[model samples]
Target: MGSNMLFVRDITPRKVNFSLRVKVMKIQIMNGKGYDSGKKTLELIVVDEQGDRIGVNIRHVLKPKFESALREHHHYILRNVVVVDNPVRFRSIHWNHETKLMFTHKSTIIPFESSQWTGPEGFNFLQFSDLKSPVLLKAGVTADVIGRVNSYGNIKQRGQTDDIPSKFINFELKDLSDVVVSCTLWGQFCIDFYNYMKKAGEDQCVIVLIQFGTTKDYIGELTVSSDWNFTSVLIDSDDVPAISDFRARLLELHANDNSVGSLAPMLTPPTNDLTKWFKDVKCVGLDDLRPDNPGIFVVHATIIAILPDEPWSYIACKKCNKKANTVDKNVDLTLNIDELLALERYCKKCGEKPKVQLRFKVSVRVEDDYGTASLTLFETQIQNYFDKSAYELQKSLPEDQDQPDELDELLGKSLLFKLEVSDFNRDRTYANYTVKDATTDSQFIQVFNEKYQTHKAGDDSYSFDVVKESSTSKVTSSTKGDSTSTTDGSQAVDLTADSDNSPLKKRIKTEPGTSPMSFSSSTNKPN
Candidate 1:
């Protein structure tokens, strides 16, 4: 019998089976601060049934009456508050100067948290001791990760707390099966992870390997914290193991009490040949690939262009460099200014700004199988193939030589290229390769010429063809040179205009736009 039939039978009056409907109860609300055009206010509360509260200070909530009530009183509660899940956290706020009001609000909020939650049956939990140190996993390891995220305090300067600023991001590690502990990343890692989470949302799973951490408690629940000395974190995505299938195997191994050595290292099949695979493969936009693990991919491309090389310098005026001021002075006016100005205003090492030549770059509008993208090529790479250093080539050219010769060659030529793409996090990036080889293919030129001719001819159906043929005749021939064994047998045919009977008179005209004239005439009696 089907499960639905069983359910129907149980619900019927004739049946005596008993069932219960689950209802969630008990809510906790968090207190947070918010601001508007006129006043600072308190915002909505984030709560869980377990009596945990997370503060929410969204700007949109400030426009409603709830914000005013919460601000006047330290707290306010709605009797039958409609529970909305995954409210966006305000990441940034932008205001309009003219209107003197908030114009835009940016937040990191997801509508569903299911992608960030793990159930008992979801993943296989390995004990901390069983895992090896400095292990690596591929990007394809798992579909997603579910864990509790917490924010640690910012990093302050040692000598002056007001100067250099940094942030720390901490995550409490738990899965469907077991709870390990917590891990924290400082400085750049904190910034990178935060950006990745904000962009990837809750769907993408990030594989994190923890080193040297111990269990502890913050308030009442048991949590893990990393000691600064021994622990480190790395995101791995190489040779992604069979996580889903491994769950069953893991349980069997535990039942058998097997050691970690008994398991073999996971291996992945080799990647396909890029040139062969990508030739017919369709793309929409900007494609990104990374040789490294944890890569980013962006699709759909347009407005494809390249930026040529420009000169850069390492030095500037010391006084103006340190000070937050702009300095403008000619290279030759050092003497008069130095006498009148303070010694502190001494002329630093200054010269006429060296003119830098811009190299040829290529840009293309492309669409990947998914979306559109813009691809650009730098002058250095183009010069690399032409056997010329960018500096040497640019310096020797005249100011009037606006376009470099190398660039002219590549103006319409197609070539194979690769690109690396990254979002907010530099670590979580990828690379992609385009397989078109523009140099060898002449088909593009032919197509271009045909299109040009069609437009000029005003008839799209016009076509041109070349023909070759052979004609023969018999004739008596004689040579006036000495007959005694001529050493050189080579002879030259005279093609100049001749009034005598000549074979050239019978040749057909091949040039286009000429009148349709004939060469052969009525034959005279030859006998």
Candidate 2:
């Protein structure tokens, strides 16, 4: 493509020496001479005139030789570079090559000069649908995804002492394909995203590109998350052609829709809808959880008691984060320390024996004014309520104490609970409601409630009317006319009838925060 330049796909092990003009996407400065048999090295990810990419390990001695060429998103020419096997388990990028390029004797890199042939930014982004691909879902397999921020959640930080606390937040990314992918950002990346949204003063049409992100199968659903130093985030990056094209396409698709730019107001709403429940997807009472209705519902409740003597934590496969089992097929729920360390655990999901970590699965009885129900809080949601993890809490206990004192704190604390309901939990009194998410923050709590129970009349909350939503239909408008349309990527009958249904937190401060699925016809944006 460029005089005498070989594309990344053309390189092979049969020919160890080659010349190529490539764009560098900086990888890590791998520590020590230790990894490569006493040769401390630097690895850079590079892309050719085509969007294809490969890992290039600068030989330890050659690391310094090429140190000055380590510019990200810059082009360069390599002469006489070598090839080696791609042996690492978690690859930097998702190229299917078995061998990687290397810097060897006589290898040299010079800055690429031709701007006319600059192919692309080298981002081979994963389709939103590809996030479910097992190959990409590997613990460290980097996945790149691009979409406009559909919705987001609060910035939740946790640390026993506040020194370098573990901070994380979740959001959704939606493509023009109408597919929505869940995203979670950790550490400083989470903080950076939070700051951007805080400044925007409200959630609006912000397009984001997550590069080198890791994917996880959270429960049964897939999620893409930032991988510490390996990942980079791009927000409304106008200079990048791909992003600009995507934004323009999004605008084109709904150009005349009139409801443009109404991304569920971030800083303030035009009205006093500070406590506006999104799309009028009202919050429900605990007693409102009926067997016929099954969808994720947010309820404000307090923990009444921790169901004791039940399993509070389980051994989780470190790689896949699923329940790990002993060879004989027993859940590692009650393994003693000696037995645990001596035995091997298997993860059916990964099909491999893996090291294990303790994870929380605490069941607590919670109560709203209407009634009390049992809920099973898992590791992700429980960690928000307790500074310490189940393992840490158990380790801190005295020999005679079976439960952690942290359970004492969860009691009486009113929280906004996002419960995922299916018909399987029809018997609300006995059914263990599995939590999708929970928040103790009052600001987020208010946004979660539909006026905090407008359904309540006297003490008989059950006496109030309940909206029977059909899977096939929903009412998107209040006018008495049959309407049909899609709502948040879902098929719905905007019936004059109520066949109904279901349904981001940047801080708008004192305002009801955003939800993972929210909508408004606001059409307002920050300048």
Candidate 3:
């Protein structure tokens, strides 16, 4: 295909010759460094028809002419190449001489028949646990690794650095031995991994191969990241036998692992900079929150009103945490009553009959001296705030009372809410603040008291002060409403003046400061 094109094994240093049917294994864009700083060069790895491999250096001036014609795993033909000695370090191929392909005046590249070439059978995959080997840690050395992705982190950029133009994806990968390591993919590798994940629609059971990756010690831990301009990532390919086998092992692990808690972190949204956000963040009043300054922030406020008219909970598919609608049993009328009844329990969200769980989802108005804002809490956060599970609370109603006593216990309590401020309105104020987490964590309370100079004993009108046992003071309602006492003797304040049939009006009798016994789903089912 080229004038006197020879096999890689036949090439000699200082002699000018071409190579034929060479399959490209790797290509890297090397920018200027040291003496060659500011110049852009191309380093190519190719294997000849005899399975012998060698590196090819394309000088900066010749890049515009030949860089685009070469692609990894593709066969190519070259002409008039000058052979030279291999680099002293980072030797990927066992060859004494490498090729230097210059502009057409000295060399040329041409497309060749790919079907006739036998490329690499698979990557020389290195185990994650063995990444710290002395031989693998040598400067300029690199290796390949294949593992299953276990977690995905947010994409982050370098701080005020112009030399690096791309962001990195922080991912957690686990090998067959179950050892886990944190990996970062930079630049195009990050973008390509995201695109592949998007196309796959789900990240589970994904096996990834990172080629020519280098390892480094980050904060006393062994970490692996892409080598500058060289590493390529392959994900979830049916043609790769190694990846296919990993998929089988992953399925087996999932089947044998009965603990659902191990999988929850993967389904939940990643907590963004938890320790940093907590340490540096100060709890502010509602009025002090600026919608223009969008980020995750903390707020301490007292619940002023609960919208009892709205849904207080949701039926969610256990697997995906999505709102689920019960399937219609009429479609399966041909089945017996028992079978048809079972069919009705299926969830539409996940397209399967997963065991459904009730999750608490409530909307309420919270207020401070400065302003009032709407707050919404989902199951996990609500459970944290009330210190009771939705199932437990739902089953706590007495035979004479319709509404559970837990709802009344939550009213008037001051809570620290971690809010995500996003989606500003036309007025420049945030349209909504999503409640990420709710807690009575002592650290939060300490921070709030230090900032506002308020005692832990609630004194403000909105605060729910624990009534002293000796004091004659009684609970007071901020809004004009009829109070329904629970069986525990705690007042259930109903602000819905128009709600004539509100079960919140039910009152249970008990001595003050006495808490009712916690109920579970097994105790009773709520209508």
Candidate 4:
């Protein structure tokens, strides 16, 4: 027979500390086939602090077995699971009509719930050096951080595909104590917070709460998590705690703020001034400007060609629509049902037909004192700024015969007025400016190019060299001697061009026993 009459023993309870491992005994029920709903019977092993495993048989609900009786003994196994103090708890009671009894439910709540997290009482600021593990932080650890909101959007992924539905307003946070980091927010947060930020102007400082996690980015950069609630508060210099405060000292424990923007290289400076000048300047419609080298003056002008707004249709080959090299379409055409079936009816790259309707072109004009030019705007930039396509603009224009008279009058006239010069081109040949005011012909417009004119003096003269050479015969006589050897010297020639050639290339030559000769050409002389 199995062992019977097992004695029960009582043990003293011991207090458990953090990170201490302990074990408690638990009784489980095991039923056989058709016994209490066709369950299987089994034995389980319970392990203790030293990892010693003990096996015991499970008993039926009504059985006076070892497992069933041991269930009455309650024991403690572990202490607090998280390092932080347990969040505060609140209780709510509910009455159940069926049971006629009151039940209580407990909830965990944070005491200081603002739009953002606040540090401990008397906490001043957090610096990078104060963080024992700056890379990873436990929840509820509050520290002051300074960062800028990034204006860029967010990126998301659903299942395996990348879905960048929203962008972020990016910011770099730093504290006087040495804490510095970047923060980003997406979607509604961006629209709400970032829009306000842009209106608030750039380089504004704000405070934020951040959570750290490992994430795989497209570019492989490690990123941290931030939410609207975590990043909503704006903290100015005056709002920060004084440096002498305890919290301020904690902030100073971390690194300094000197290394902030050093993380990324500088990009090309913004061209806002140039853009503003174009918008202020007046001119005829952008059509008059050439597509190529719209001249040096308007090199920075934003230009674009309007495209068809509506989708186009095409008669595609049942097979490949690839055109035959030979002009004879009928002779070069090859028909095959299978090939035609496989051929794509539409161009996969662009959803429209290979051929489409004409669209209007648009451009922004740039000018200097000496001249003006137009630049084509890219389609994407146009869409971003105007929220319209080139095709849509083209379709809206009146036909050549019905062109507006106002447009004609505006042609060849200045669009921007009262621009202040800010910079000049590398060779000082061109100048850049910003528009401080605008003017119209009706308001007594004064064209800047006309206001400043350059002219050359009419009486300017330059010198040229001319060379002439001539050979001459001379006779000499000596007493009691026939004419001895006659001596002759060549004349010097001037270096100058002839009247028919450019004066710069003229040259004169001289030779012994020869007439002076001069040579000239149309080429300019080297200065």
Candidate 5:
């Protein structure tokens, strides 16, 4: 205790007279991005004896002077610190102020031994139910959120900041009330979230506490992204005292309510956002694809040979995915699975000729320096690259050949493939390595390579030293756009092949909804 000891509530801007004693509630060590690249910054949120907290910024030059002395949850006394108006627009909802502290040349942090502090660790966590309130959601403020991890999707990449690309991964955080708040995390935060989830596995409890996270109105849906540089992430680690209480209460809530075990393994990753999905699936070399593992992983490889061993087209059900005996007379597709099943259109065990759609399933051999594997492309990849649906292609080609010779054009062409290794393939029940998606667009591949090219020091972490994406017009692989663009919904430039003999002779896009039954070819003659 000192005569000049100051509480956080009484601190003012540009003050240098008082010595303040506070508990280091949290400390974040992060590498600088954008303009502050190559420099490291230390951010801390310290709480006084009364539980009032203020953020502290330690510059790179003065970081070494106070780095070792600051320990989270420990008492420290600061003297001659510079206080300034905080520039961070969005701050923690409840525990926030207009001013923040900074380190000066004379600033010092001394450990205090004779501690009389008996206060909470200053985490003003926001409730999940309150996330829906217009005042909370619409207000330009940061929030502290703590909840059980429900599910997470692949990375959602948008733009580059100072040549380093920014990424977002979305997941749901469920509180004890069964209320869920969607979270979008960036950079190292995303890495740590999965790191804890992977370590916790399916049986253990994995609760998280994000301090000073951001809130955004993403197309009317509320999402919270942890602040990029300053956000403090507390996962299942025992170092933080709050996690024990959170874990216990969450468990007791479900247990007392008679809900059996810990809320874990809802693994329902999102799929609707194709722009985020197709490219961000984990990229793996051919050697990395294990037979025992079953998941969608990307492979950047060349089309070595089109395996002529399987039929490229088969009669398929329009109402569902089941194979039909022959073409159905009625093309009136029942919208729902129940309605289709009620009308005797969909069946797994029985032979039913539902309104037929021509299925395009082609097996192609792909190879890179790592190894070689057989990959099968479905209808979307086939039509987009070939500029024709399975039905139209079937109508145009000669009936005698199993597949047209033009398919040979795909050989030697490089593609980024989204390969799905299912349990069937793992169990040897299915022979082909199926591709969920594939793209021939070079710009998309450049971004993919930058993201997954090199693994960082930690598990599942990526070296995101990405260059700014080409803003010039692109021939992207996304097809959900207009007739000129490709599948995954990314915009691209006008299509053109390299030379006269290029495999990409006609770069017309074939969007997903191109009906297999809606062919415009009039005669029985081949096109």
Candidate 6:
């Protein structure tokens, strides 16, 4: 400890005031305050060099004197502050007493350089293993976590109070040891994180730092969510050495020929049963899809139209796959600091100003002889359908063009889709068919061939050879022996080995301006 540093444990509730220099870990404004007050009550999480943390609340009247000068993650010198017992309900730190910094005419505050700290200060990040530790399992225990995002779920609204529902995004995170944990961001935290990923450009690989997060039971498993108004999120932040080291570690792993897919198994892969699951389902034609019936159905269709001028993707709610719009549009954007302070008045679910992210929202029109319909496809299915990530497709385009040809290439390809019908409203008059999964497997292709009978031997039209894949083991077949079956329009049909056994999107495209297409099947050992 520095000679001038004051230990937090030594501070006790007293009538007389005291002074201490501490780093402001975070500051959050409370909600429901009128904008007229010049001073706004704010909560602060501060820590000493010894890693001791204490909560601090600046009274509303004293806020004007200190709020503008106070910056998070910065060291501050405080004078004439009273110490009191921490309110149990609002405690953000473990310390027994909280500092009450007031704005007396004589009060003094000094902002010092960040270089004063010898190393990363004020954070005690726990490992994924720590979530199950006995101490953390006890009530009121909280800590920080740093990890790489493995996969993210959709953002959804959860009812918190009778009046307002809180928004959340569920995501899986992995620590350096490759231990995976489920994490959810609540309220504004969800909005902030979703928007952060959008602007940062780096997707799954970026390291994230979570502070003041608390643990809870989710689906009978331990999970973490941002503690109200206390938790802070930083994505790919280099200010912390742990984050910087994590970035280097990822680079090193990639350099060593360790692919990010090495962690793919850690993810709960789509089950092999998905094939049998698809087989047992009855297939429906595009015209047969009805708002009158709400059920999951299988459909073999070809993309007939790509909606023009629509950005093929958007950042969606991790849970719902709906566009994640700003949490609040009512907040005044003209004022600088006051607008930020005003955000605290709304409940976490309503959000002060939620951020929108980019997720896949591919809209395509599909058709069969029975009928044609428009369908919406979100991230997971889109990734499966295209064999590419929405982020990759989005980034590959030139800045001037919003509609990439990569998406345009999806047109005129035959696919089998698991369609889900969910009514957006109660009437069911406006139900939409969402593409749950899209694949070019033998089963779907055979169904298309049998139902449509669009392909003929004499015609230059292409036909897919039936492929039998076993769930438990790898399978391979040769293209050399099948040359006689392939027509001039038929390209080499090589089915990539997929360990999960989910069919890959291998479509037969025409040679520009021609509808004639062909498919030949050759399989390789599953990778």
Q: Which candidate is the best by TM-score?
A: 2
Residues 17-86 of candidate 2 have per-residue lDDT tens digits of 4688888775566654445676656767677778777778776777776776567777788888777777
Q: Estimate each model's TM-score.
A: 0.20, 0.53, 0.41, 0.28, 0.48, 0.46
Global Cα lDDT for candidate 5:
0.59
Taking the tens digit of each residue's C-alpha lDDT, what string does model 6 give over 1-527? 22233567776555445567788877777532444255447677777767767777666766677777888778977766666555343333344244433345556677788887653575777778866665544335456788887644334445211111266766777787778787778766676655554343322365667777766764344677777756667776676677778778866766765464343212111122233334434455565566666766677777767866334665433333344343466756454332443343322333433433345566676766566666665554444346566656655767666577777666777767776655531133443356655655343344445534432233323333334222211111000000111111122222221122222333452221001111111111111
- Order of all candidates by TM-score, from best down to worst? 2, 5, 6, 3, 4, 1
- With candidate 4 superimposed using the best TM-score fit, by how many Å does residue 439's alpha carbon deviate from the native? 24
lDDT of model 2 at position 245: 91
lDDT of 1: 0.28
Q: Write the per-residue lDDT of candidate 3 for residues 240-277, one digit (tens) a residue.
A: 67767876776677766654223222311112222333
Which residue segments of model 6 deviate by more than 4 Å? 1-5, 12-17, 32-39, 88-123, 139-142, 160-165, 187-204, 219-221, 227-230, 237-241, 251-258, 263-527
Clashes of each: 38, 11, 5, 86, 9, 18
User: By TM-score, how accurate is candidate 4?
Assistant: 0.28
User: What's the distance in Å from true for residue 61, model 5?
Assistant: 5.3
lDDT of each: 0.28, 0.60, 0.53, 0.26, 0.59, 0.54
Error of 3 at 507 (Å): 29
Candidate 2 lDDT? 0.60
Candidate 3 versus the native: TM-score?
Answer: 0.41
Q: Which 10-residue window in model 6 sums to the lowest lDDT? A: 475-484
The per-residue C-alpha lDDT of model 6 at residue 223 equals: 75
List ranges where model 4 is wrong by over 4 Å. 1-166, 178-180, 199-205, 210-375, 383-396, 399-527
